[model samples]
Target: MDQKTILVAFGGASPEHEVSVITSHQAIAALQESNYSITPLYLTKNGRWLTGETLLDLKNFEDLKKLEDSCTPCTFGQNEFGQPVLLEQKTGFFSKPKTTPIFAVIDGFHGSKGENGAFQGACEMFNIPCTGSGVMGSAIGMDKVMAKTICRANEIPVAESVDFFEPDWVDHQSTLITKIESLEYPVIVKPVHLGSSIGVEVVMNQESLIRAVEAAFKYDDHLLVETVITPLMEINCSVLGSSRAQRTSVCERPIGKEELLSFQDKYLNDAEAKGMASADREIPAKIPDELTKAIQETSVKVFKLLSCSGLARLDFLVNEETHQFYFNEINTIPGSFSFYLWKESGISFTDLLLELIDIAVEDQNQKARRIQSYDTNLLSQKAVKGIKGLKSKK
Candidate 1:
């Protein structure tokens, strides 16, 4: 049998651009040992879509300018047979552009449009199978305020937070500050729609709180200020499969330098080649088995509530003293695809990726079974004539 082409799509105009590159490279390396043919779909910071063999190499990313210059500019389109293809341009006058059929798309993106359903919408338009959460799930997972609200409504414990847009802050600065202060000092401020700890800040006092909020607005229009959960222990669990049938991986306790985990702690500190998998964390987190069971169960609940599919890592903040935890955030297209957690759960990295592809294909097949359109034409000449005749009688 011929090898199927799995388009490993990543990189975007977000703060997590470099991280996404690392993730895509990681996925490509694992898939290389598999039966499927890997195709690199690199989206530059400026939003240019390109693909080529050069993108599959991790070393090329060190100097992105030269690397992008070596890639072939491409876009999503269909071939003569209406099958989805990655169309690339040719410079020569007589040479026609090349077209490669896409069997599926591996959503390896980290933040921004890549993980927030925009890219998923593109895949749906092109009628191609893409991994990870669908549009609704991706969009909600990316928005912190929305995710919290939904979880709260579902009786899931979430830290109390005060959310406001940039305009709300600008117009009612004092009022917003007062409301946040009610949550008390030393709160966690976050950009509502960003991840990788890009604009997350732990503010102790009012002065610091104002500064943090201001800084966070630079990355996103909306911000969330939640009461700090000190004596805090950050535990994360990865959920696999779809909303219909899902399972949670072993819980992990991530170590941080300060009260909160910074971006440096997650990817910059000991990161070598594994991306998020390189982050310092304790697998089968040193918590009671009972607590671990609770967290794992909660993780699966949030995964299904958010309508997530493929794989997602759910972060939770636990009170070290009380052993109580609150659902934090969800990484729809988690960095390194959260293969590290799955590895500890008895699934290898390659196997995890293969599972993601299988889930994507299954999702696409299920969608195909749905009734999409009607058999009768509402815009037919007979229909139009009847409508005109009725109008005349009226």
Candidate 2:
């Protein structure tokens, strides 16, 4: 059989764009020796989709202007065989667009539309397999309030939070502040639609809370203030497979340099920007066996509960002394694919990628097996005649 084309899709209009690029590059490198041909689908920060051989090289990204000028613009389309393809739009006096059949897409995005179901929805529209969660799962995973509300309803522990849109804040700042302050002091303010702690801030006083909220508004219009878990120790567990069947990897305890894991703390530790693998963390976290087991079990529960497929990393906030934990959030397309945790679980990076691809293919196959559309011709001559009669009557 011929080698399949795996489109490594990444980058988006989000604060975590660089982190997404790093994750995609890491995935590309791991899949280099696999039985598949890799294609780069680099979505620029300004929202242009471009792809080329140059995009496959990380060095080319050093000067984005030069890189953008050299890459070919591309879009999704159907080929002669009606197969989904990545059609390259070449600009020239005598140039024809080239189409490459896309067997599947490796979604390595971290935030914004790329990870919030928009890109996944596009793939669904084209009837192609895309790795990671589907539209509903991705949307819920990216929304902090919705995810937490679902968890809370499922008897899963979650911190109390008050969410408000920009307009709500503009019109009812005092009322919102009163509601948030009810969660008590030292609450954490976060942008609802972002991940990687891009706009997360731990606040104490009302003055500091207002300042943080104003600052976070720059990143997102939807904001939430949640009760902070004091003496917090963050634990994250990765779940693989789908709702039908799945397993959780060994839990990891991330070591933040400050109060909470900030964007810089997660992605800026290494000079080479080695993605989440370079972040400070303790694998198979030294927590009690019971705590670890609880986290692992809860991770799988949340994954299946949210209808997540392929893989997801669920983070939990723990009260170090009490050993109590609360589900924080789920990252559908986790940074570095949460491969570091999986690595410690005895699964290699390449194997993890392969497993994700297999899950996506299985999902697509399952969908194909179902009735996609009605076979009858609704626009038959008889139906047309009836329509003509209605028009004649009118």
TM-score versus the correct structure, for each prediction: 0.96, 0.96
How high is the CA lDDT of each candidate model? 0.91, 0.93
lDDT of 2 at 299: 90
Candidate 2: lDDT over CA atoms?
Answer: 0.93
lDDT of 1 by residue, 105-217 (tens): 99988889999999999999998999999999999999988899999999999999899999999999999999999998889999999998999988889999988988999
Give residue 283's lDDT in candidate 2 (0 to 100).
86
**lDDT of residue 72 for candidate 1:** 92
Off by over 4 Å in 1: 385-394
lDDT, model 1, position 89: 89
Model 2 stretches with alpha carbons more than 4 Å out: 91-94, 376-394
